[model samples]
Target: MLYHLAKNLIMILFYPLFRIKVTGKHHIPKEGPVIICTNHTSNLDPPVVGITASRTIYFMAKEELFEGKFFGRLLRKVHAFPVKRGLADRNALRSGLKFLKDGETLGLFPEGTRSKDGKPGQALPGVGFFALRSQAEVVPCVIISDYKLFRRTKVVYGKPMDVESFRKNKASAKEMSEGIMEEIRNLYEIHKN
Candidate 1:
């Protein structure tokens, strides 16, 4: 499959180029529906997390990436789906939920967009909506680096947080988003060097 092939090749290629150091990989559950929430830094963040994680991840990419014919098809081949930005895109939300319901791994960037300064930012409420609605375990991951070529970059995966408690407590979407971001910040502070 294209996804697997790309991942294998990237695994080999990115190592020398980025010196991709990974930690806390065991924190990712081997099976079942799970969400991997990470900070958005560079355009390469998706693939970086994909190859490093033990499971195949279907990501929620921005809609414009799928505008071109060839590129759109290629993105699909790699298991990336388009999501309209700057508003609540229902179609995109359904796609994400369906993926989770089918017991697939879903990768998300809580910040919703890449950070120009490579620092974590506040998350949109979408991630929290998905977490609470699907009752999926949310893993807080942090990618530490300036993403400079041929430099060391660290991807740290933190333990999965059960969102079921939040769901039971009737937490708001914004609150859930804040909690997830806080988890990501904690992981970043601990591993950032």
Candidate 2:
């Protein structure tokens, strides 16, 4: 499959340039509907996180990346879908939920965009909405690196957070989002050396 092939190729290329290291991979569920909430720091975040994960992660990439004919096709082949930034993209949201409902691993950047300062930012409420609607275990993941060539990049996957209780309590989307981001921040603080 293109997904496997691309992952392999990317690992071969990135491992050398970034000296990528990974930990807490066991936190990722071997199988089930799961959501991975990660901090966005660089464009490399996607591939780096994907390479470190044990399972395939379908990501919500920005729409601009899919504008090109060939690159768009390739991204789709690798299970990455486009999301229109700066708006509530219903189609993108629906696709993400559908993936989770089907028991697939969905990767999300709760911050919605990359942080220029490499610090975790407040997560968008959309990730919380999806967590409540799908009831999937949300795992906090963080990638620590300046993403410079030859620099070491560490990717850590934290224990999954159960949001079913929040859903039962009728927690607001903003509350759930804050919880997710808090976990990500905790992981980053612990691992960011």
Candidate 3:
């Protein structure tokens, strides 16, 4: 309920206020378990994609955010789970797989955290792991440029890529992960206006 309410309210409130323009809406799949991977820019990037997408995006949030009583509940309601950064957060990983197995879409930055300079960062191997484990098609996404007033937000939606194919082709785990990140980087290049 919180996800839906916050999603609708924030989009109505901040979209016009921020003048946030979204493109490539048709690229998002309407059903099934899909992974939405993008480069993390600002703190707003998560919700920006979450509300804009037509599905409830189950995502991993920093563990500290869920420590707060009031805020924790709110985050949980919105399909956000806390994952320990820099260490294995097994619980968080389990939740992600569960959501996907349940036929829900999951959102991941692949870059791991918000970029300090708002530039694309190196993506983590966990993204590749999940894609391989879940066998879900990855929807490569990019948020171009900054969020300053009148700054254009060009989102490029690339065709879904096959993680299994990469794995089957004898690509090492790191190689496959880098391959996924490279795909996102290429899309970023196109949408970076």
Candidate 4:
């Protein structure tokens, strides 16, 4: 409820300022557990994706954002969970899996951090790990533009990637992560032109 209300308010406020354009929304799966992988370029990436997506997205936010008690509670209310960066956080992983098992959409920024130059960075292995373990389809999203105010920001959602193939082939975690990142990069390129 709060998430939708916040997203609606954001859309009303930011849409005019940013002129955000979301394309390929139909690519998002209508049902079932799914993972959304997007290239993060700015702090605004989360809101942009969350608001543009048709489904509720539970983001794996950095633990630092949850440091304060009040703010942390607010974040949780909006469906954002804390994730410790730089290492494998089993708790975060479990939370993500639980969300998927419950047939909810999970949003992930595979790079783990925002890109400084607005380009897709190397993805963390966690995304691939979750995709394989949960057997959830991965949707690649590309956000175009530098997110400057008054400029058009375009978000393109690509078709879902099958993680089951990688699992069947017994692909390594690194391989799965690279494959998913490649798809995200391709999606970015496809929309960049």
Model 2 worst lDDT window (10 residues): 162-171
lDDT of 4 by residue, 1-88 (tens): 8888999999898788899888999999889988999998889889989999989999999999999999999999899999999979
**Per-residue accuracy of model 1 over 1-193 as CA lDDT, tens digit each:** 9999999999999988999999999999998899999999998899999999999999998899999999999999999999999989999999999999999999999999888877789989999999988957799999998878899999999999968778888999889998999999998888877
TM agreement with the true structure for every prediction: 0.97, 0.96, 0.92, 0.97
Model 4 steric clash total = 0
Report how far off residue 119 is in candidate 2 (Å): 0.6
Model 3 poorest ten-residue lDDT run: 149-158
Clashing pairs in 2: none
Ranking by lDDT: 1, 2, 4, 3
Q: Is candidate 2 or candidate 3 better by lDDT?
A: 2
TM-score of 3: 0.92
Backbone clashes, each candidate = 0, 0, 0, 0
Instruction: Name the best candidate (by lDDT).
Output: 1
Off by over 4 Å in 1: none
The better candidate by lDDT, 1 or 2, is 1
lDDT of each: 0.92, 0.92, 0.80, 0.89
Total clashes in model 1, counting residue pairs 3 or more apart in sequence or in different chains: 0
